[model samples]
Target: MPQVFEFKLPDLGEGLTEAEIVRWLVEVGDVVAIDQPVVEVETAKAMVEVPCPYGGVVTARFGEEGTELPVGAPLLTVAVGSEGALGPVGLVDSGSGSGSGSGAEAGSVVSAVGSGAGSGGAGSGSGSGEAEASGNVLVGYGTGAPVARRRRVRPEAMAVPAAAHVTAAAAVSAAVPDAVQGPVAVVSPLVRKLARQHDLDLRQLAGSGPDGLILRADVESAIRALTEGAAAATPTSASVPESVSAVQPSRPSVAQPAASSAVERIPLRGVRGAVADKLARSRREIPDATCWVDADATELMAARSAMNSAGGPAAGPKVSVLALLARICTAALARFPELNSTVDLEAREIVRLPEVHLGFAAQTERGLVVPVVRDAQARNAESIGAEIARLTEAARTGRLTPAELTGGTFTLNNYGVFGVDGSTPIINHPEAAMLGVGRIVPKPWVHEGELAVRQVVQLSLTFDHRVCDGGTAGGFLRYVADCVEQPAVLLRTL
Candidate 1:
């Protein structure tokens, strides 16, 4: 007999707690190799393919596609052993051979119990089979060498009475009367949370899953029933006697109800939810302020075009406008380090960071995300441009990892792509400030003591007021604007 190893969902890291199953790569009874991608799941940050460490035949799968499961929930089980050692076992309903039908069916339940007993005896005899531990230290399992299996307790040795099984089955048809009478079989924390929110006793509800495991659907149904019952029990005004009525209008006028058909409700979840939560927290905790300035970008645009035109094959990637702005922001932060730090409110201290981990905002079909470029202060415009391009592509493809989406000391938001002139950007939480760049368009400006058509852009800086005063914020914005007006101003720092 093969030893069955249960593989739970691994931590996708970056403080993510749950993910929605997007697709399954393996099915029940399929052979899988070690470290092979088993399933694709969409977390709050990105879409990730989770790999299984054990190489074996898939014995069971827990959740269906599109189902949201918390981290550490069992993803699947694999039976590992020598080739042809473990024959195909029906896995739809746990060692029970309950057939692919309703668990409430009497014939299926009886067959499942009988088959479980027989399998238990077989499992006991083959307990000496060798089983190796996959050396991968993931969310649940740890690394170790292969070890000989211990004999499993036979089902016959600790079997529940057949009458008890019948009683549990009968409980499925009728509501459980007492909450403390028996154990409630529930697996998902989300299910428990829902039950707790509604003050519904799980013990008083029979589960529809294998071994009477309470599923989310079961709890939802119980809540629905309770709601309908309460609504029905409420007395209506029409039932009151005319004699007991306080006062009645001779002619009652009915007001027309407002139309709700035009309203659309989109669930705030996944990337959108994460963004929403962070923004709300930033607003709640950080004392933020925004300042804007218009600058002549004629020199900056010309410099970029000239550099790209002069570059040969070995000259490397062309610098982007956003990269130039990012580079300038880094220089500005270096001169005014106060704007590059976060406030440790609990400690009642302001942290002035050293290195700049610059994040840039990118909008994807899923939602808006800020992908961080590590050590942006050390990178030149060319290097920063390349990284931004790579992260943007990954964002577009939904292939960015959680680590790539977090830990930014400062953020550069280029909202110009939306054709906006300026925006009061919200500070990316924990970080002190964000620089927003608007579209660079030709405008009539006074240059060199004369009015001329110059490429101009609006720059906005939103900083945590707790960390810096208006003077510091104003100075930082002025330096950035100066760089835009005269690209040569960056030469001194370079």
Candidate 2:
């Protein structure tokens, strides 16, 4: 009998529960050596290629590309020893028929990767466990048994009341059975509650869940009829509209006031998800403030265009306004060390980094991705421009790695891309500040004490007040403006 061993996903890092399988380097019937990179897993942090723990023929693969698999779940079953370590096929659900084995049969004897030698046989139903539901991940090989634990609840509880009406409308349209006994159809939890509280008939309300269904608003409107008479009697003009007092033309009655709720439901995922987490942490952890300034960069623009025209040694990736702005911001960070830091929320402390890796936002079809320019402190204008070009291309091509996305000490968002003047852009969380760049437009400006049309831009600096004050933020922007106004000045500073 061939000795069979199961490989389970290990915790990649900090509280990660699952990872998307990118590719498998090895295939079934292929001989593999120990510690060989057999598979690649893409986590939120980065893409990690995992090494094989044992030398054996690939017996079976249990996951597919882009499928998020829970850590501690078996990845593949490898047979040990000489005579082909093939065991019964381990099935995995990949939706398409392309995935391997039907997984372990219920009551079939199987050992999980982290489970010890003395594990009880696999007891299966619909495979409901922490391995399937949790987002915590396991990344590497370990000999110990899996930790037994219960579900982890969120620190803050989510309230349903605020969205009850919306859900009720969806449910009512879906035709889910409800206890509404009237002409109006029952919709959602909130709608049901509203109707019962106001003594409105639910059967009469139409649903709006999936179809043109009734919702909480339908129920709320029914209750409104009773109270509206009393509200109209009040003397406040805001309470009673002018039309209500005027002689109105009689029109055909509209269909029993179909539910008309105006609210947008956006899924909290991807960029939106990251934005929410960062904003919440920033609010809970950092004190932030803002500073603004107007900069005349005619000389800067002239120099940049001249360099690009000559295609000189300094020439690189069509010198963009954002690239110039990034150079200025990075140069200023050297002058103000405190701005390039993060706060330890637990310890209530600030951390100043030694170098700058400016996070430049690149908007893509998927979402906004920020690929950092590592060691921005050491690079010059040309190098910065080239690196920015490369990183931006990679981001747009969807080829960015997780490492490229992390460790940014400061961030720069160019709203100017969409032709906006200036606005307070949210600080990419944990980073003490984020600089928002506005459009470069021709405006009247004083040059050598004479008024002239010059390329002018607005810079908005939004910083964490907990880590920096208004003065610091203002000084930083002033320094940037100085550098851009006289590009040669950077040579002295560098």
Candidate 3:
């Protein structure tokens, strides 16, 4: 007999509470090595492939793709205590499953399974004895010990929208097959999850799907039957409906849905949910103010062109406008350090930061993400530009780590790429200020006291007023604008 240890969804750091199963990498009875990716989950932070810590035969898997599971919920089960423990990615170090993406460390848990309890959860693993487990499983978090509690499945976890239910029901009715008895005709893992939640035995209920496939409707119907029978046995006094049955023929079964009243419900999860929560928190906690100014970006443009055109192929990577602006932000923060610090509400003290971690907003296919450059104050424009390009590519490819997305002391949002003039951007929470740059275009401007056509751009600064007064914020914005107009002013700090 093999020992079965259940693997639960490990907390992928950054205070993320839940994750949706994007895809499953292993199936039941498949041989999975230690530190092999078993499932890919999408958290509020990023999409990560969770590596299983145990090396054994996969016995069971929980939740379907698109099903959201709370942190600590069971992910799958592995039958260990066998020979030939394989290392999928590379060398496994002392029970740490450090072979998959980011080298996730799965906890070392060894629990002997009985004859029929292969799919038992954490608590059930130690049915008759103590289940000893320890160590971290995720990138930055874990129980570090065996902490098994009875799992309570939330109703909303397995909830399907009314529209989806109707659609599934329609699909079931449209298909009918010959009555054939074979393996369990279950197409969706969600139906199994729903049944487990309600404690309804799926084996007892007849499926209505084609080829007798056990669908969600079948589980729901069985649950309804149990609920109705339980309610009837209670002998509760109810409102009499004896006369309503005779009049039922005159009335329709259900009110027809109004064509205009149809609605599609979209769950705000993953990246979208994270953005919403952060923006809302920033609005609630920070007293922010926005100030805008139009600047002459002609000189800045000329400088970038010259630098990129200089030294030919030996000039390395071309400097982006955002990188130059990022460098400018670092210089401005040195002078106006007040806008670069966050407020400590509990102590009510303003702590000015020494180094500047510059964050810039990048719009990807998923949503808006801010990838932070570790230290902009220490890097030149070329270095900053190269880093920004790297982070942007990671954002587009959805490979940015949580550390790259966080720990920003300041932010630069270049809405110029969107062809917009200016925008009062919501300050990224915990960060004190954000500099928004609009598209630069050739416009008539006063050059050397003469009206002439020059490249002009609009810049907006939104800062947490609690951290700095309007005067300090204005000074910071003005210095950035000055650097744009006269690139030589930035040379002084350089």
- Tens digits of per-residue lDDT for model 3, 1-494: 23457799997888989987765776544556677788877777777789888766554455645558899988876655423211111111111111121112122212111111211121121122211232211111122222232122221322323433344234222221112111344545456446545544444456768876777766766655544444455333232122211111111223324444634354566788899999999999998999999999999999999998889575778898988999999999999999888888899888788989999999976689999999899999999999999999988877787788888999999998999998999999898899999999999999999999999999999999888789999999999999999999987997
Alpha-carbon TM-score of each model against the true structure: 0.70, 0.61, 0.67
Which runs of model 3 end up more than 4 angstroms from their true locations?
84-256, 312-314
Candidate with best lDDT:
1
Clashes of each: 0, 41, 0
Q: Candidate 3's C-alpha lDDT?
A: 0.66
lDDT of 1: 0.69
**Total clashes for model 3:** 0
Which candidate order results from sorting by lDDT in descending order?
A: 1, 3, 2
Per-residue lDDT of model 1, residues 1-494, tens digit only: 35667789998898889998666766644567778788878889988899888876654566654457899987877666553243213323121211222223322333332222212223322212222132110111112223232222121443334543354345322321232322246655456546654656565566779987878887777665544444455334344333222212112323323333323255576788899999999999988899999999999999899878885664667889999999999899889999889988889999898999999999987789999999999999999999999999999888999999999999999999999999998889989999999999999999999999999899999999899899999999999999998999999899
Using TM-score, give the best candidate's number.
1
On residues 383-425, what C-alpha lDDT tens digit does candidate 2 reach at each position?
7888898988876655677678878999988888799889887
